[model samples]
Target: MLYEKLLAPLLFRLDAETAHNGALGLLRRANSRPWLQALLAGRDRAPEPRLEQTLCGMRFRNPIGLAAGFDKNGIAAPALAALGFGFITVGSVTPRDGQPGNPRPRLFRDVPNRALWNRLGFNNRGADTLAGVLERQPGLPVPLGISLGKALQTPIDDAFGDYAYSLEKLHPYADFFEICISSPNTLNLRELQEGSRLDNLLTGLVKKADDLARSAGMARRKPLWPKFAPDMPPILRDIALTKCRELLDPAIDAVVMGNTTIDPAFNPDPAKGGYSGPPLFPKARDQVRGAAARLEGRLPLVGNGGIFDGGDAYTMMKESGCPLVQLHSALPYRGPMIARRMVEELLQAMDRNGVRHVSEITISQPSRSSK
Candidate 1:
């Protein structure tokens, strides 16, 4: 209530990126205090048994995860984790240091539509810096995944090498790695999602990640899920999924079916960046539905994009037959209590549908077959 009535409006008055930095800075201070996390979480709530799921060896208290860009360099992940998120994915970090992203005013908001537009091209403190943060920070309660991307200046041909550097550096910290080849903000990064290029990238990274985990004598190889763009053409989406399926062994464990969408159709402003929030819900859900059909239950797909509530969460999982879902753009609008609200409403949604466990969820609506 305080957030919606006051803090949000106050923050919205500032520049989008500035508001984000101020909010994150507050969470960073909260990270050191247990009570602060509890208060920010809205309550000392217990995990609802109905929402818990174990995917890729990680136990998720709920299907709602904070998407990658929100906690880019891992600044406030621990505090965010305490806010009832099932998981927290940090980074989209590049291998090289000081990759100053695109110029200012990179993040924009559309309050009336409940959406955001951004071209903040993989901006971060780099993999090494994130590695230090993870090493020094306390471990989170929920599963933590690191999103890996190529340095903006790196040649697309050597993309895997860039991802490999981050993989090796952050391997010990991440329970999973999200290969982000789909962010529209990065130059030519999405090309890595094309046929043979995707195949080589996943295959090579899979082998490299395994080698790292083995050398370090870790309990097991970390899971890797490619974060894709929501606007990928159906043909390219299928090709990417096929390559992922082929490399399932000691490779691609799950898939984050999308990042933000760059489709002009969703953005009324004709902005030169991806669009996220409610407007993207339908397209992103359909994308996962298609991917789910193509994979034929062989691999798990993490349904992501435009999820602002438990109804959307339920819809994402049920309509797409995906076990999990993630959200980012909803945060500013929904406030810090977003995850908790989503969880409670998700339970309400589950009760209404007579559904018990989230894993037992399946596609409920007639879906278009992948083209």
Candidate 2:
């Protein structure tokens, strides 16, 4: 109530990137003050078993995750986690040497339609610095997913070493890894999502992970999930899924069905960046639906893009078959209390839909589906 009525308006008055940095600074402050975080969270952070879900053998307290690119350097996870998210993904972080990313005025608000245009690219402090940051981060009640992207200077052919370097350095901090090859801002970045390239990247990553696990004497390596684009045409979508089917188990743990959409309808100047918000919901859902139908429940799916409320989350679960979903632009429209509200509303939605829990809404999953 207070956020929308008071704080959000003030934040909106700033430029998008400035507001974002200001928000992270606040979260960093909260991270230094546990009591303050709790006060802000109120009764919102408490767990609801009805929303509990299992991915692989791991349990998530809820389905709502703060999407990657929000906290690009793993700087605010502890405090963001305190805000009642099931998980927080830090970074679509690049390699050892970080890149400056795109120029100023890269992030814009499509406030009228409740959307954001971000061409910030993958700016970060590099994985080396992030590893140190995560080392000091206190453990949170929820899972933590880290996104890996190729270094800006790395050529397309050498992209493997760049991503592998990040994975190896940050492996210990991540509960699951999100290979981010779908961002529209990076030049030729989406090229990695193609069939042969996708196969090699995932295969090499799983192999590297296996070696790392063996060296540590751990039972299993961290889960690796590749993030895809929402606006992919049928043929391209199939190619990506085919690569996924080939790798599913020890190679790929799950799949993130989308990044943002570059559709001109969603943004005034599509080249500046893609859009994330309400208009992206149907596009993201439709893509997830098609992928689910094709994968036939072989691999679990994470849905990201324009998820604004509990109804959006519920529909993603029921119609699109996504058990896990991430929110980005909603924070602007709905305020910081969004997660708690979404959790409560999703529970109510489950009851109205006649399901006892989120996992029970398995209409899209096939007989083989478990996660």
Candidate 3:
């Protein structure tokens, strides 16, 4: 209440990217204070009866997570985990060690619609630096998912190698891995989501993950999920699912039901970058449900995009058959308190639905038959 009513308004006055950096910087510094960490820890609500979930062979203290792009470089994983997210996903980290990304003014806020648009272009300190940060930070209270992307100038043919390089360096630190092939800012990146290209990419990635697991003497391979675009048509969706099934080994754990949307209907402002928030709700849900139906419950789905509150999150779970969901834009609109509120609301929904455990509700619906 205080942050939205007072602090956010002040922050809103500055450019969106500047405000983002400033806020992260503050959190990073404050996180150094034991008293601040204690305060944040106390603010976290006690776990609800059925909200604990174990997915991809790992346990999540709760279902709510901070999505990728929030911590583009893994700088604040410890702070975010302390604030009570079931998981903190860092990066969309690229393989290259060069340029940080587009100049300022790359991120914008469409305040009236509670949406955000960005062409930040996978800005990060590169994979090696991110690996070092992960090693230095205290281990998270919950799981950590790392999102990987191809380098800015890497050609499509060589993207697989770039992604594999990042995976090799960061795998030891991540609980799960997310392949980001859907961000619209990158040139021809969407092609990677197509059948043929995706097959090659996953083939290489799965092999690499397997080798890493064996060498580390781990019993199970890490979960590797592909982040998808919300705008894919049914035919394209089928191609995506088929490709994933054929190419992505069962060792590949889950699919996050989207990155963001490039659809103009969702973004009325004619913004250049992908748009995320409430407007993306319906499409994101449909895509998740569609993918679940086609995959026939074989894949674990992490639904994201347009989750503003618990009702919205519940809708995504029920309608899309997603077992887990993540939030990004909502934090800025509702503040960090949003996580606590969402946990409360999710517990209420589970109670009303008579679901004993959250994972039991995941992918409960079978795909609808085509007419």
lDDT-superior candidate, 1 or 3: 1
Against the true structure, candidate 3 has what lDDT?
0.81
Cα-based TM-score, every candidate: 0.95, 0.95, 0.94
Regions of model 1 farther than 4 Å from truth: 250-252, 362-371
Candidate 1, residues 1-371: lDDT per residue as tens digits? 88889889999999999999998998898888888877776775865887776667778788888999888899888899888888999998998573878998899998988999898988899999999899999988899999998888889998888999999989889989999999988889999989788988998988897799899997667888988888998888988887877776422288789788878777665464888899998899889989988877777788998888999999888887888889999999878899989988988999999998786795222222331
Q: What is the lDDT of residue 205 in candidate 2?
A: 93
Pairs that clash in candidate 1: none
Which parts of model 2 are misplaced by more than 4 Å? 250-252, 363-371
Question: Tens-digit lDDT track for model 3 on 1-371?
Answer: 77789888999999899889987876676555656755534465566657776667778888788999998888877777777788889889987462477776789998988899888888889998889888988887799999999877899989998889999999889999999999988889989988779888988888899999999999868889888888878789778887776655443377787767888877675455889899888888888788878777766678888898888888888776677899899888886567777877887887788877776767632232321
Ranking of models by lDDT: 1, 2, 3
Instruction: Output the worst ten-in-a-row residue range by lDDT, candidate 1.
Output: 362-371
Q: Count backbone clashes in candidate 2.
A: 0
* Per-candidate alpha-carbon RMSD to the true structure: 3.3, 2.2, 3.0
Please give the lDDT score for candidate 2: 0.83
